[model samples]
Target: MSHAIAADQREHRRLQLAPTIIRADIEQDGKSREGYLINVSLGGAFLSIADPPAKDTTTTDLHMLLPWGIGECHVQARTVWEQTDDQERAIGAGISFIDLSEDASNQLQSYLDRFKELSIEITS
Candidate 1:
């Protein structure tokens, strides 16, 4: 599906997030899972990861290293949706931000703006 349509469906702003994959350790179970993030809005983020919190687990906490070398941001997120393959392996997940720092939010917005500019350049 096109990014725009997917974003629209999810009620998220469509932006080309230059994702940086990272290993995430959740506070709940102390389980280490790979998480993908680039630009995240208040609504949700499109994450490409191998393992994710199950549908039963509604909430998670993460220490994410965002762009701008601003250090890790302690983030609280809620799992909105998750999709897996027949192998029962997670392929992607959508997480809604429950809480975020002001600096982190600003950095995310900047990343989104840059992604938009890059997309426009490519399409035009």
Candidate 2:
């Protein structure tokens, strides 16, 4: 298959997560709480949180903290999957980042560099 076709079948950058636990701050209903990042793709991310809203929670402000710094991206998220953690904490959320600002997107990309390096190290 062509490279493009293979790439299309995969998510952006095929990011190889490093199992690094990253924190996410999600706010809704006039309240905010912390969540842990499961993994990330170029256009979206999965998070573990308690009692996340239903699917298609559109036009919500999501704050993602990367190693470089904190990034604020507007997102339209949906509840793709949900499950309780070992601690019996409700977790699991999928978010489709949308209309991200150029700068914000750039920051996210830069942060993913760490994952790339980790992937290289493992492969080698």
| lDDT values for all models | 0.62, 0.64
lDDT score of model 2? 0.64
Clashes of each: 0, 0
- Model 2 alpha-carbon miss at residue 65, Å: 2.6
Error of 1 at 121 (Å): 2.7
Cα lDDT tens digits for candidate 1, 5-66? 67666666444455445444455566556577533654556555667666636567766665
For candidate 2, the clash count comes to 0
Tens-digit lDDT track of model 2 for 1-124:
8998667447644654445567777777677777776667656666777676667666545676576444454344545445655566537766666776777767776767767776789899
**Candidate 2 RMSD to the correct structure:** 5.4
Model 1 segments more than 4 A misplaced:
1-27, 38-40, 67-73, 87-90
lDDT: worst 10-residue window of model 1: 14-23
